[model samples]
Target: MSICILYYKMFMFYSLCLYFLSLYLLNLDFTLYLELNILTLNSISIEMIVYFDWMSLMFMSFVFFISSLIMNYSEEYMMDDKKLKRFIYLMVMFVFSMMLVIMSPNLISILLGWDGLGLVSYILVIYYQNVKSYNAGMLTALSNRVGDAAILMSIAWMFDMGSWSFLNYIDYFLMNKEMIWVASFIILASFTKSAQIPFSSWLPAAMAAPTPVSSLVHSSTLVTAGVYLLFRFSDLFSENFMSFILYISLLTMFMAGLGANFEFDLKKIIALSTLSQLGMMLVIFSLGDKMLAFFHLLIHALFKALLFMCAGFIIHNIMNCQDIRFMGSLISYLPVTCSCFNISNLALCGLPFLSGFYSKDLIAEILSMQFMNFIIYALFFISVGLTVAYSMRLSYYVLLGDFNMMSLNFLKEEKNQMLKSMMILVFLVIFKGSVLIWLMFPTPYFIVMPFYMKIMTLLMIFAGILLGYEFSQIKFYYQNKSLKFYHYSMFFSNMWNMPILSTLGVSPYFLTLGQLYLTKMDYGWMEYYGSKNLFFLVKFSSQLFQSFSHNHLKIFMGIFFFFFFFLILSFF
Candidate 1:
């Protein structure tokens, strides 16, 4: 058998086993430790400490479970590529790094996993070797570098604990006034990784990667890492800090929902949806409900990964075209892909009894009963409504309307390999919600709210259906609606112009600064003071030496001696 096939079978075995393992871990909680001599600073021994508990075990099991499927999926998805082996190697290393992050309770050891994630993900983003891939990879890598730097800054402040394990001495962070800065720094790091607000452009731009990479990145691992970290450290934050996170997360969700509505690219729309979901997880975390956030995180991963795979199949059929405007009636042509896509989309919309409904409905209910201001409540519901609107709008434009492609597109291919992995994920997307709820929260939650508020999600959901359908029915509207001529339309359609802001905002200023430094510091001032002036001095010394060695030795010595005698007389 080929190596990729062998590897696929092994991971499939592991993924099947991990489902049972995740269930078994719920009943037990324990910590296992491993220590290694790392480094010595100021003659003090520093040991890298690793920590694992039920939380870590449960999360690690899911990570492995999902990663196994992603690898298996990529086997066929990347079959034609020359660099398939290299991609697989990076994928495996990426999984290992995520495992490290999940298992380590110490900030010190987690840094290894953390940095590995940034570096490997950067490499993966640029895997295609195109200008678009290069730009996307740089945007991805630089944005994440900010978070890596923040982690280092937090580690420096953590020196007071004398150890890298924050779980061992969480009180040090909670007690010190200065340690609040550490928490602040950690929050900033999470923002960069999770693509919150100003860091939002990279998430959509990252659609330049292949489909399997998008599935792995947007769903279980890379983007979710920030929420997992912040959720792990949620206990260390003050209420004010919690409030700061709350507002920002809401804004991120709001921004992403708005962006998705205006977006036409299929992959980018899905990427924006992931961003919106990350914001939702952060909301629950900010509310001091880590378990609920985790529940949402797991559920979101299952459906979103499935959604990306389904989209991949469609893109594969459409000759790699991603613009939704060119797609319609795919339901008739690609039934299996359309079914998977619709199921995942419905789950995302929180259609009752699906995976997302269980976790997302609970979150909205819980938020309704909490002591929140009107704007927060409104933003939460508005974001939720936007999710449904965009989902329906995407479906209408891509599945229900007339075919919009300009040429005869052939789509006779049967996607056996991609569909095989998706079937496994489809089962999870359908049922993982109730399974996780049974394991994580054995006791049912009782929510107290007004009847109208209780059904608000249902109301918004139906409203979205109406608006999305109405908007899509007008064929001439889209044909005549000039997004370019309409300036505000262009602004939002272009992802709030964040790509321009981030690229132009940083690149031009630095390019100008670099120009000045190259001219004045490196070429001009440093040349004169460092090389040019030294060259002249050396040349004059060489001339004097040559004169002394030839006919001018006596004159040279007389002048030198006279100057020495004058200096001696002045001192006397």
Candidate 2:
């Protein structure tokens, strides 16, 4: 067998082994450890600090399980792509980084894994290397870097405060006044990583990547990093900070809902909805209710992954288009894809009797408890309404309209692969919630819901769908005359006069000054000539000194001298 084939087979076998190993480990009654490391710093100790109690275990398992499915699906999804080897390498790296992040024992280790995953995801996002993909990669990288810096700073602060370990930090953070700032910094990090609100633009741009990349990064791993961070550090956030976190969550939820309405591209719509769902997860976390947030994360991952996978099937196979406006009735021709998409959409809309309904309803209930007032409650209600609108709009525009197969030659084999992947996702979306409930809370009383709240939520979803369908039917037209008029009227009106002047005038002076400095620095001739050869011999000797100073050892000594001088002066 070829080396590549052997490598691929070995990787598949390893992944299968890990999956079964994780399952077996989950069944064992592992003991929990919540203690600080008393050993000295820099010791290479292997301590098993169990952060994955029942709650964290639930989310971690979900992440790993879904990631395995996506990885399996990708084997077929990218079977024909030219860069299959590079693709598999990055994909496996991404999955491994996520696993490390979820199971990390220390904050520093987790952040390291998180940043590694972010880097790999950027590579995957810009894998195509076209102009649009390049821009998307840069944007995602810059935004994620900002988040990474925040997290690094927070970690530094924690270590400086004598809490180098996760358990130690949590215990200290619960009562520390500085925790408010730390928590705020962490939330900022999460917001950027999760693509919440103003940071959300890059996510839609990221759709230039392949559909499988979108499914894995947007749905399951990269975008969800922030939410996972918040859940991991819930104890660190003070109540005061939690209030602000709640407001940020609400703002992101509302803005994402609005953006989704205005988006025409199908992936963009799903991207916006991802932001909205993440915001909801933030809301649950901000309530200081770990169990509820954990549950929400589990349900969100399954359904969102399913939704993205189905969308991928449609875009990759059925229509070969990512714009909702261009797609029409795929129900008859791609029934499996349509059915999977519909179920996932319903879950996203929080329709009754679906997995999304249970988890989202729990979030709403927590919000009500946290706010307990008319204004906040009503705002959440409206946001939930918008969620339903976009979710239904997505379903209606793509699946229910008149059939429009743009080309009859769309690949049937690819369509079959897409359908098979969607079926796997669909099965998970249908049953994962029940499994979660069984494993986490295995009693009837534990799953109780208030009757009136359920009814109101159901009504809200129905009303939003009704409004969305009605809104879709109304047509509006734009005149080409307006575009021509704007082009003529403002073509030269907004030119950058200041930049033009700077280039013509100010920049030349600075450039000349820079050149003079460089000349003086590069040669000692100016100093020798200025001294009129009075110290010509000394100047020539100085040239020897300069040449010697350029030696690496002498350069190191010079830097050491400079630092030592500064240290002495500061102390004095």
Candidate 3:
């Protein structure tokens, strides 16, 4: 069989597995109700616990549905890849691990699933085994490991306090005095997984992976795992830490928005945008408002996934390159992809009447209520402007420029299947409600904004687009080396150098120990120290004392002595 056929067959198998898993979960819920009734009627002494709740049920349902669609779409997206079987296997493993993560009853089980997902994602990121791909994979794995360690430490701390089951221990964990450490660790995990602030660099690098992997991991499902963790543990951190979370989230949103505006790579732009959006979602999560957070999560997943898939189509079918500068006038050639791309871009810009508008407005409303400080409000306003800037920049660059026929023809000839898969995702992007519905949860305050405020927000997006167009038209020449160096350095500095510093700072310790061991081997340092005159005299005296104590039989005598000592100690 051809690789494409094999890939489709494997995807079909995963779809079947997901279908059965969803059905089983549904049945499990029904069986729980039946058992509850049986126990009530019989008055039986049954000690049982139920961990599945509304949140878990909702998240799991979404996971299954989205995974099914992505896998189905992958039948086309990954058709021609040589490692098709391995791709399918890793994708299945990723979904299965995510399912387990949502359904886990305890912290240990959740960690197990979390690590499994991270491992499989890393492998998938480096599936091509190119240098850039390997580096991206390594960065993702390292960042994830930092998060995983935090999670494990938090779980251990909780267990040490005598609570193991998450359902039962969550309240206790929250109220404990040591919960500050736990919350910090949880924040670390969330920041790394969601690619917020300092950890944001790895996500852009993750673009080296395939378009499907980039769409699935960076944009849609996997990266959101961190937000899911925070949402799941919202109760534990909300009461005392909500304000701190809000500030941190706002900073992440602002920085990410700025970063996205400056990025030129198509996938990197979306990746940075996703980070910013996730940060916005984190703000919602920090509001102690479950309903708003849940709705935002749903809508963000739908539209962001749509945007990434559209970007993938542009990269694979319209531009034949990752750089947006090389793309132009793709709307005429790839009308369907372009249309979907525009709608998703509009949604991302939080244009009124779209999914992003409702969710983002909800978050803004909650923030306005919680934050009395004007600085934070101003930051929020500026972030709104930045969001407009980046989203419009992305849309204008890819769809509304002069046609580059050579590039367009190359993509059309080479990757028709990718275009087909993107078209399916585009359709979903336009009418996402059919696949997933946003449920509005109750909030303490009314989340309605005035008509004028909505108008102003929409105007900001338009103004951003106009500004981006004007900026794109300006021509500048880089003739001097100093000028080029200054511009490049400023760009990287603004993008943040924390990722670089962390990488370099952490690498030397591992090398230093290895070098020290090699130096000892070369110099015979250990033997030299032991064989010195003072050490030899001490060794001779000790050996003489041991011989006087019948050292030849010391091994057998020592075992017997230990056994007798244990026997006597046991009786005592």
- Each candidate: what lDDT? 0.84, 0.70, 0.69
Best by TM-score: 1
Q: Lowest lDDT 10-mer window, candidate 1?
A: 476-485
Stretches > 4 Å off in candidate 1: 16-19, 36-45, 413-415, 473-485, 532-572
User: How big is the positional error of residue 241 in model 3, measured in Å on the Cα after superposition?
Assistant: 2.2
Candidate 1 local Cα displacement, residue 88, angstroms: 0.9
Per-residue lDDT of 368 in model 2: 55
Clashing pairs in 1: none
TM-score of model 1 vs. true structure:
0.90
Give the TM-score of each candidate. 0.90, 0.76, 0.79
TM accuracy, model 2: 0.76
Over the full model, what C-alpha lDDT does candidate 1 score relative to the true structure? Answer: 0.84
Model 3, span 1-572: residue lDDT tens = 64444544555555456445545555454322111221332332222233555555656655554555565556666666776777867876887787667655556667777898789989988988899889889988998899999988987677554443555567776577777787788878888888777787777777787776776675446788888878767767755577877788788888877767666788887887787888788777776766667667767776777677777666656435787777777776777777878888887777766767777766676666564578887777678778888777777777886664564275442455545555655555555532333322322345565676545555666777776665455322223546664476346424566557566767799899888876785446665665565688898999987876776587678879999999999998
User: Residue 341, candidate 1: how far off, in angstroms?
Assistant: 0.6
Q: Give candidate 3's error at residue 159 in angstroms.
A: 2.5
